[model samples]
Structure formats: C-alpha cells, structure tokens
Target: MSLLFLAAVNVSPEAMAQGANDEVVREAQPSQSVQNVLREEHALFSDRLTIEPGISYSYSDRSNLALSGFLALDAIFLGNINVDTVESHTTTFDLSTRYGITNRLEVELMIPYVYRSSQYETIGAGASTGGLVEESVSQGDLGDISAGIYYRLLPEAEVRPDVVWNFSVRAPTGKHPYDIRTNSRIVDDGEGGFENLTVPTSLPTGNGVWGVSSGLSFLKTVDPAIIFANIGYTHNIKRSFDDIGSSEEDVPGEVNLGDSIRLGFGTAFALNERFSLSMSFTHQHAFETKVTTDGGPEQTVIGSSANAASVNFGATYGLSDTTSIVTSVGIGLTDDAPDLTLDFRIPFQI
Candidate 1:
C-alpha cells in the first residue's frame, strides 16, 4: 500500500516581511491547476469537510512450470511437466472523508468494498493422461478500513518546501484467507482412474491482520509545476488462525506477514487552470513471511519476499467550484507487480 500525506499552501517570506508602505500582499489563492495537482498528491488541505468517492481496478497474471523428471543426454529425455497459470481481477469502491482540525492538522477515514475474480489453469497435471484443467472463483466482501491523521511540519516558502508527517492504522475487517476452505474435484483419467485437483472456494478481501504505517511527504511549487516525494514503512501484526492448512485436516497456526517499505516521487504540470497532468514512479519491497504451526517451530516461507515497481500517470479536471475528477493509470515494471491498474476518483467539498 502507498502512503499519502497532506499539505497546505503557505505565504512566502517576502509576503510576510513586506512593509506597510509597500504594496499590500494579497492573500494567495491557488489556481485550478494548482488545486488539481495538490489534490492528486494528497497535499491539498481544506478547513471545510470534504468527501471523496473512488473506484479502482487491477489485473494480474502469473505462470509457473514444474518438471518431475530430469533430461537425459542434456536434451532428449524428458518426463512429466506441468504448467500452472493464474489470472486475477480485482475491483474496489471506496469512500474517504477528510476534515481539518486546525491550519496544520487534519484527520481522515476511508472505507472500501472489494470484488474479486480469479481463474486457475493447470496443463499436463496428471502425467500425459490429463490435458487442461481450469477452475474459476469469484467473491465480494468488505475490505479493510483505515483511519489516519496528518500534520504539516513546515509550510512551503520561496526557499523551502512543504513537509507533512502522517500516521495511519488499518483494521482487519474483511474476509480472512485462512478461514476459506479448499475443495477437490475428481476427473477421470484415460485408464479409468480418477485424479483429484484442489481449488479454493472463496477469496480473501484483506490481509487478516492489523497494520500500522507512518510516513513523511514533501512538496514544492515552482511556477507551472509542482514536485513531490514521499517515503513510508508498514508493519503487520502476527495473528493466529484456526485453520491455515489447505487440506481437509485442521491445522491451527500463527502467520506473521512481512513488513514493507515504499518510496515514491512525482511531478505535476499544470496546462491550464482547470486541467493538469502528472507522472510518478513508486516502488515497494516486502520482507519474508514467517509461520508457525501448533507445537511446531517457526519457519520462514521461501520466495515470499517481493519487490514491486510501477510507473503511474494521472490527470485531474475541475468540474465545479467544489468538485473535481481525478484519474490515473499504473503500469507494472516488475514481475511481482500488477500488469495494469486504473483508478478514478471524485472529490466534493461541503
């Protein structure tokens, strides 16, 4: 998950030091372009209550191959080989609300609903007797709910950038992955024997653990463009589950999900008062996960650590005085990342 920080516009040093005899320094009013960019960066601060509704879609496909026998003479002999592929689609709708308690302090809350579909395919699973076996599963449920607070440490100035610190907590309010059960389907082989294939009956909507994150963001405005950067860390609490095994036997265990570190930087260019364009790069690295079964020692899950990177492009258009449309597209740059993601949001201030 990406951590977003809040920001606010500030008066320049010159404006604050101006003498009474000199021309009056009128209060700074952000143009539509500036507003759009600030909102995309989550830097725009408002004293009035604001509500934002957003929707996002992401797609991912992964493939794996396994060989049961080794080749003879390095080329000629081969045994059973199986190929497994998984394609997943996820859609989420969320509502976020923000309120500024003071000029430098703000609070926010977000609630999300998620729907997911997945297709699993296996080829050559039952030696040479089986062709292709496929299974599909879909589920919809509530997602994790989160709340956070933001504080502006330093306001933007001619020689300084705006600095904001943020902290957030997430609750495990969605479906638990460990609680979902897997079912097996038997298919007849060429020799009249049956082969069993197991697949999950449902999908999880959340990580099933409490999460806490903290970060700092900085933003600077230079004429027609705004530059921003942020870095954050997330920690997941370990939790115990009644059944974490895939087989029919009950296996109670404790799962400790890996923590993650994320970094992002971007710049937004304002073409006009009502439209703007922005591009950014983000990367996250997750540590290895650990699990322990009842009366068993803790073990690290191999190949569980991952690095995900993506490039994102975004645009914002002003619709009315109190509303604006924000849209973004993300392209994956690594195997662990989603192939593509699209996000749309609309913010309304009361």
Candidate 2:
C-alpha cells in the first residue's frame, strides 16, 4: 500500500527554479550539459541508490456469524450458531533499498519485523449449551521476508503511460501455524448435564509457505495528479507439514493454498508541493484450495475460495526533505474483507 513516492522531494523549489541558469551553463559547455541534465531530472518512481527505512502500524476489525456444529438423531435436529468477532493491531518496521542497475531496471530488497496482537470473541447457542461468550488474546509475528525487481518496459510520454513489470519472491521466515492443539473442558449443558466443549486458539503469524508473484504496473502523470494501476498473481508453494489439523485430529499432508489474483488502481493529487491525497480500490480473488494427504488423493477444500475488496483513502505529508508521514484508512467493500483498517507509516530516505 505504500511506495517511495517522495524520493525526489529532496530537491528544493529554489533548485528547480535554477533550471534557467543550468540551461545557460549547458549551452556554454557540452560536458557540463550532462551534469546539468542529471541535476534537472527527477524520478517519480524508484531512483538509483535510494535506501528507505520505514515503520508502519495497521489496525483492523472483523466479525462473522456461522453454524459451528450440529447434532441430529432420527427425526430430531439440534444446531449451534457461533458468532465470532476479532480485532487485530499490527506494527511493522521495514528497511527497503532500491538500486538501479540501468535506468530501466531496478532491484529492491525489503526486510521487515512484524508484531501483531488480536482479540477473539465467540458466542454460541444451541440445545445442550446455553449462549456464552469466550474470549482470548494472541500476539506474534506477521509477514514473511520478500525481495522484488521492477523492469521498466516503456517510459512515460505525453500520451503514453509508463509500464513496469514486477516480480517478487517471498520466504517463510515467520512463525507458521501448525501442530496446534485445541483447549477443551466440560461446560454446562442446557439440560443440566455436562458437555465437552472446545475453543480455537490464536493464529500464527505466517502461512509457512514460500510464495512468488508477478505483475504489471502502469503509471501516468497529468500535471498535478498521478495515476497508477497494477494487476498481480501469487502462487504459494506446496510443502509438507507434520500436522495440518483444524481441530484435535491430525491431518498431515502437503497443503497447496489457493493462488490469488490482485487488481488495484488509484490516483494521487498533489495538494501542494509537500503534501498529497489519494484514493484507491483493491480487489483480490482466491482460487479453491487443495490439500493432499500422505499417500492419499488430493482433495479440494470446500468453501475455500475467497473474494475480498476494499476502498482506501490516503494522505501523505512531508516532514523534511528526507522524511515523510503517510496515513490511510480502508473500508471493506465485501464480506471477505476486514470491516475497517487504519494504517500509518513514516518513511525516511537515505
């Protein structure tokens, strides 16, 4: 959601106005013209030798209602409805460096430390058990480490948008969710007896799978406004695990998570030379997940496909020539998305 858009803001307005003087110097000497041109050129995207360090904070809230389980015998049926809600807060510190091997090629490395905390609440009602609220808190790591490269295919022109091809590889560096055990106890049954009940534990910070992504990005500048769009696809590499159980029963297998397609477009308008505002929409569609058990056939997980969308509003303010603050709020546009998200980032260019 964040990019080094302010990398070129180190140039002062006074220096920009010196273009007239630089042009005069260029006309007087050919060798100085090369230096003058380099000084005048401002890169809107990644420039050579730019290293950016940033920290970001994000918060999101979500809720869902589902039928957890049911009991039936003969012609009688009993059902339970579980209302689940969660709120998560995450903080990530990342250092990203972009180096241009050529004017049209850039390589980037990004490393991140992520901390996350989430609160979970569940309320259930049924025949044997009365409605009760169970709550728990969990916190840990979040995203994996990743590296990327951007290759510019076409440069921006008066009528043509700049095009870039993006490729990235992700490593499983965070704590992966696996070998989880459920907490269980005897609870009051509505009929005065007791029933064994179980509740879910906290989630892990990573998926434990390597991933790769490729995409195409486009950008255009129109005076006071900039337009950007991208489409990407990500594939998660299948890996074997000791245990892959949703509950107590062990289901060891090689899991293949569903691949996803991401589409996004946005526009940023410069309110002034030091500030900008943006609005964007993002959508993702995940294919059905398939899991293959040891010596068993691959099975498609039911209800594993997901569609999520969000609308985001963002603003960026310059704190200095090398530092900036960026903030964004996202509203969910679909049931699969978080109800709301808030993010704040501070980035420094070195």
* Candidate achieving the largest TM-score: 1
TM-score per prediction, in order, is 0.90, 0.78
Which residue runs does candidate 2 get wrong by more than 4 Å? 1-82, 86-91, 125-130, 190-197, 246-250
lDDT by residue (203-321, candidate 1, tens digit) is: 99998999999998888777656677888999999999998887778999999999999999888777766678888999999999999999999999999999999999999888986
Steric overlap count per candidate = 0, 0
lDDT of 1 at 151: 85
Show where candidate 1 strays beyond 4 Å: 1-25, 194-196
lDDT of 2 by residue, 161-190 (tens): 767777889898877775666665444556
- The 0-to-1 C-alpha lDDT of every candidate, in the order given, reads 0.82, 0.64
Give all candidate RMSDs, comma-separated: 3.7, 6.6
Report the Cα lDDT for candidate 1: 0.82
Candidate with top lDDT is 1
Cα-based lDDT at residue 191, candidate 2? 68
